[model samples]
Target: MSITLSHQDKITLHTAAHGAVSLMVAADATGRPHRAATDGSIALGSATGLVGHVLAEKIKDINLDGKSVAELADHVLPALTAAMSLLKQQAPAEAANFRSTVIVAIEAAARTHQAQPRPTVTDMIRKITAALDAA
Candidate 1:
């Protein structure tokens, strides 16, 4: 059976990353509610935020093992160009956010599934992220 990420799952995952980033930014901006943890954990925001940070970090290794800039540029530019051309024809802000949310959800699901062998998610986010970056 094919595995998939649900909408709720995506929101939770993205919220983690987005929330952590926001908290870090907030802390830096406001400079309050800060405490040094005795335990070895980076204080960002909530568990979801932490998970996002960790996931983002883990993906760096995968990125290192994947395609080079030039190769990815060649592979992704055409599709991006075409897609952007289409997106530009219509208002794409909401659509873009939806796309991003879906992507993050897919990533979270993949991460969960990939923790075991016979990975069901199969690293969909990494591939998508790489392509998006290249594009």
Candidate 2:
């Protein structure tokens, strides 16, 4: 079945991706460095923790509109990679952490997106008819 995203849904996805990347950049700017014997050196910040969580949750709800997992990954990978690159320049340790976190989050979102039930043709027709009748 063919699937489509409303303009608003497209905007939401775009905004969410941008916001997540922006947050990561902000985190890199503000993150604190720590040196530990066991853990070595790492950077930590609220923004760092928040970026992955927010992106994962926001991306999870995005309407893939019948796209395959690969398609979804293709769509999001660029943004994630760009963010990773930015983080790498500012904070190498944090970049590594962000890379792993983003990968896991994206994979989880892909699974969640795939698991969601798609609207059947009949469901679509009914909704369209209801809208027409209301109008």
Candidate 3:
């Protein structure tokens, strides 16, 4: 089945994905784990004024079929590209890091899942952050 997301959905997802990378950077800067930072950040609603609500809602609305991770990446490429452009301008290093982290995460997730259950945004974030930390 073909998957579709609205422009707002894409933007929200992009923000959340970027936020995940930002979270990793914050954790690295503070010498903490991504999970810890995620907890503290959520408790403080650090992203509340930015894209929290939209991210949560859009995540809930997403439903993935039996698509490959590469396909999934392709589906979101446009949104990712747009976000990367802005990120590159604001924080080039973080943008490069986010790009690498996301690509690796997608490939690993696809390998791990194969064609079983579809992946969720939360799952993707968890995997991505874990992979980032391990690397």
Candidate 4:
């Protein structure tokens, strides 16, 4: 049977991953001139934090019996999808760019987490950023 982490441990893990994601996003969110590798770090950082907050509120219900990576995606994907939809409705232009990047990042993260034998917060963020860079 899979060992369950204490609530605090789970929070710590989420926080670490979220922090990494935020930094990555902010590095590329400079807008207009689009600093690319730099501006997104801030935006990513904020987005991860927002996702973490949502996850924090729903932590107890997150099923961990399956893969931990899938569990993480389950916690964060819906929020990301909703955010993307909301952005699309409120800011079509921004959404065009954000949607692809966010979706790419999340998918890459999920893939990386699934493939890795021992996934870490840094690993997930790096994979996501690498995917974003490739895109």
For residue 29, what is the lDDT in candidate 4? 32
On TM-score, who's better, 1 or 4? 4
What is the TM-score ranking, best to worst?
A: 3, 4, 2, 1
Whole-model lDDT, model 2: 0.34
Q: What do the candidate models score in CA lDDT, each in turn?
A: 0.32, 0.34, 0.43, 0.40
- Write the residue-wise lDDT of candidate 4 on 8-66 in tens digits: 54443333334334433332233221233233333433443334333335455333232
How high a TM-score does candidate 1 get? Answer: 0.27
The parts of candidate 3 lying over 4 Å away from their true place are: 1-75, 113-135
Each model's TM-score?
Answer: 0.27, 0.30, 0.34, 0.31
Q: Candidate 1's residue-wise lDDT over 22-116, tens digit each? A: 22222222222232111102322223322333334422211111144334334333333333333333434423543354344433333222234
Kindly list the per-residue Cα lDDT of model 3 for residues 16-100, writing each as its tens digit. Answer: 3544434333323423345434543343243332233433343443322214554443344344555455545555555565555
- The full ranking of all candidates by lDDT, starting with the best, is 3, 4, 2, 1
Q: After superposition, how far is residue 76 of candidate 4 from its true place, in Å?
A: 1.2
Which of the numbered candidates is closest to the native, going by highest lDDT?
Answer: 3
**lDDT (Cα) of model 1:** 0.32
- The clash count of every prediction, one per candidate, is 1, 0, 0, 24
Runs in model 1 deviating more than 4 A are 1-85, 114-123
